[model samples]
Target: MPSILGGDIDPSSWSIIQVDLSQLNIQFLILCGVAGIDLAVEVMPDWSELPYDLLVLVSRCFNLIEDFLNFGIACKSWHSVATKHNFNSELPRIPWLMLAEEEEGNSFRKIFSLSNGMILNKRIPKASRKRCMESMGWLFTVGEDDGETSLLHPFSGVQIELPHQYTTVDYYDH
Candidate 1:
């Protein structure tokens, strides 16, 4: 009986049921009935096949910036659609503020978006034991001993090192 189903079903299970779908028509009918009654068994559509314009429209309709960001990050296809659209202008006017707290030799930074009331925790690598300054979406980290300055984007994870002798205060002043 399992050989008839092309080895997809176990012979032991066939013995338990005492019946096998002996015909293709009977199998088709059973499958159609099961599909109609079972929503969980429904096939998922390919998100990559969705139109770019439609995805952008849906992404821009999100109320929260975090949700919008997450929608874009859901897949590479979705991200490509998001990057091509000017959805950032549609986001709420949120001022992102960086708040830092130091505890037990570790520094924790929280970025709060005033418009959406979303607080995001930002991780700064290699700057945990250093003096850090946050302003205008940029983190300026200064090494305690070497006094080296590095410009970091906490959320985007992009870091650039300045000249070894560069002063953060002087750089910011200019």
Candidate 2:
């Protein structure tokens, strides 16, 4: 009979064996001795400490923004790579559908993705207590009672105040 590592061995002496990678210390040494393999044990790598360029390369493989955001939360180094705005995936980003506000004074809003049927709860305090409309990737908001108007970039948390609804001239009234 032929041994698994090569050369001939007695079939009567052979037996089934199972090795676990996680508990590969003493058992691994014993296996190497049996197989005539002279090798040293090596330590596993810490994934969080991977090289910066390698992490960036891995980050670029994620086409979904949700997956990319989750990857950033894995470790500080990964977060740095994710926040660098360097994603260059060939695939386009999936558009998210912003659901209506749940209740008054709620800081979170539910966003749905059509591609994967995913729902993400995003914290958007600026849209609270306002009537919001999506236009050109910006949230056009108007205050319910104060009649205040503004344009908000939901993801970046940027808010630009516009003139009050009553202050703007009615072009249709000409």
Candidate 3:
């Protein structure tokens, strides 16, 4: 609605419309508010003046663009400013592997970015996961061949096998 943020609203009905705030939409709305700078540009139709006081008021309370997004849901005034912020910044990084006490019980199957700690993937590539554990720069025997073992990557089709025991450990040099 055109009367989203600052519309000289007399009734609180305008405020009630901010019930379902999607995060992406809210961010866009904040960015828009920043772009619509003249309060005169708002009130005068083809010449609404940018509400500097309102923008300042909103910006001060909205420490982050995300905060302005949340405010946009409250009323039309906030919606303008909320939609004006930028979305150039990066989000948090996700985890790479998630393990649990049981194979199918409460699990922690997610990889967050090592840079930002945002949740990334929720799977472990059996072949490469061992490599992550081996990131310490040491090769160790993982599973002994009591039965058939399949080494595989979860996201890719790469695989390997260690079928029989070797007589000498010098077969392959690290």
Candidate 4:
């Protein structure tokens, strides 16, 4: 009783909905929901105390499931759930190339992957939300005048110079 009262709030009592929640990382969601402190008071019904309410928990599970999907798409942790079938289907059959971004209104830029029409690179982690929409949404490319294009992450404001002039660990890291 003391453990339940003083320990972290836990929603593990609820089970996965058993639906096609492949888009939602159920395991990761459970971990997130368990982080807050325990409830201040436990409600009672029919003059009986319930350790946990199953109905509310089920609802919370559904909500968390939605969050999990968004979380996966926004981050790199469970991105597999988003592109799990890319290589196994028609997504990998046709290939496209990344072209250079042209004039103000021109759209001739970046290679689109054959798989899912992406840049042949996985989605950028949500941590780098401002890094580049084109990072994953569009394929990066080198064109005739594509000299050392700066990879400026709008979020961190970190600019990684493309077409590096020097070979170092930082260049290889990205």
Q: Estimate the Cα RMSD of every predicted model relative to the unseen true structure.
A: 11.4, 11.8, 20.1, 24.0
Where in model 4 is the C-alpha error above 4 Å? Answer: 1-97, 104-111, 118-157, 161-174
- Candidate 3 colliding pairs, count: 45
lDDT of 1 by residue, 1-174 (tens): 447656688658867565554566578778979888553566889977788888777877766556667887888878876653546564555568776555635656667888767777766555666677876667788787877888887767788887775544575465
Provide the global lDDT of candidate 1 against the true structure: 0.70
Tens digits of lDDT, candidate 2, 1-174: 556778786654453232344356777788989999967678898999999999989999888877888999988998999964766657687788999999899989999998899898999999999999998889999999897999999989999999877766883474
- Candidate order (TM-score): 2, 1, 3, 4
Against the correct fold, how does model 4 do in TM-score?
0.19
Task: List, in order, the clash count of every candidate structure.
Answer: 0, 0, 45, 6
Per-model TM against the reference = 0.49, 0.57, 0.24, 0.19
lDDT of each: 0.70, 0.85, 0.44, 0.39
Model 3 lDDT tens row, 24-57 = 6788778878897443454444212348565645
Enumerate residue pairs that collide in model 1.
none
| Residue-level error in angstroms, candidate 4, position 163 | 11
Steric clash count of candidate 4: 6
Clashing pairs in model 2?
Answer: none
Question: Any runs in candidate 2 off by more than 4 Å, and if so which?
Answer: 1-51, 73-77, 89-91, 104-107, 171-174
Candidate 1's error at 12, in angstroms? 57
